[model samples]
Target: MHPENGLPENSPTTRVFVALAPPDPAKDELARALGPAYAAYPRMRWNRIEDWHLTLAFLGEQPVAAVDLLRAPLAELAASRAPLSFALTGGGHFDERVLWSGIEGDLEALQLLAEEVRALVREAGIAFPERRLRPHLTLARTRRDDPASVVEVAASLSGFAGTAWRAARLHLVASNFGRGPGPIRYRDVASWAFRDPAAGGHSR
Candidate 1:
């Protein structure tokens, strides 16, 4: 199934991703850090703090039955790696429509995670999207006419450095796209803990 957001019935319905979520304290810190920038671009759709996550892989719509099959590998992966710490820095837009914050620090770890997730998807026989890994946390969406504001907003956010937080859990979020003005509601369908580092690829 595809992710819950904007999917048709009878088709894969879940839009899935392997992600790193900030702890509560980090979320609070990010909200506090971004409050002013949020006001500067009043028209942009700023994502809610609770929905902030660093996505490692985006598994577009898939059949529901595959969720369990997908989870098994991710759980094993999580159990091996230690929680990663990363910092947010700068902002940019994708075709003037999507606004996102650049990620830094521990980037090697993030890259490794992406590679591991890609391998797992292949082993599961999932049709993986052909795209390079460009790590960034999407923060807002900009309207056409108001795109100029995002450019300035990105520059203003150039120095934002939120506190590093644990990446202890990987959430399988279900998104409801195209029907809400607020942040997409995400729920954990399954989770796996970090296994001992000595377990080869599974280790932190």
Candidate 2:
């Protein structure tokens, strides 16, 4: 959200996305597995545990009113679907600079859901860059000086296989990306249950 007159020039646009966060139990499980890497990769800028999430659609910046058109449609899409079963499996690096944990199980369903979200965004007249979905939880960022650290860390986690968990909520989130100097923080604009409570389905 932006306030005219009192905010920066770019305030009129907000950075937003659609995503799903793992429940505390699932996140905790991954955290435990990475305990050793935490100390070994001290220079890496680790993301806070609470901020971990898998983005379904990255809808960069847009007029706040344009996003409003998506509210009802997204809720309806989520309600028509059921929760997906997923597990954190292994690890990887992007350009050897970003470390992430992989996602597996129900992958076809996950891809279909993401495609639907992108389509809904288009229907709302929202435009965004198209990137192939590589499902993962971004764990940290490595520095240019020591790109090899992330590779070692990724190798160590190659055998990790976390317990399966249900993904039940679809969240529309806004991020404080260019607003100030600090770690990026995210807040949910709104969230909807994937399965409707009206027919014996519930949130996790």
What lDDT, from 0 to 1, does candidate 2 have? 0.84
TM-scores for every predicted model = 0.83, 0.88
Q: Per-residue lDDT tens digits of candidate 1, residues 1-204?
A: 225422334655566666777778867766776788777777777777778888877776666667567777887777767877777777787887777888877888889888988889888988857577898888887777887877777777777787765577766665655546765565556666665445556354
Each prediction's whole-model lDDT (CA): 0.72, 0.84
Off by over 4 Å in 2: 1-10, 178-181, 196-204
Query: Considering every candidate listed, which one attains the maximal lDDT?
Result: 2
> Which candidate leads in TM-score?
2
Q: Native-vs-model 1 lDDT? A: 0.72
Q: What is the C-alpha lDDT profile of model 2 across 9-108, one tens digit per residue?
A: 4546677888988999999998998999998888888888988899999988776777667889999988888888899989999999999999998888
Locate the minimum summed-lDDT window of 10 residues in model 1: 1-10
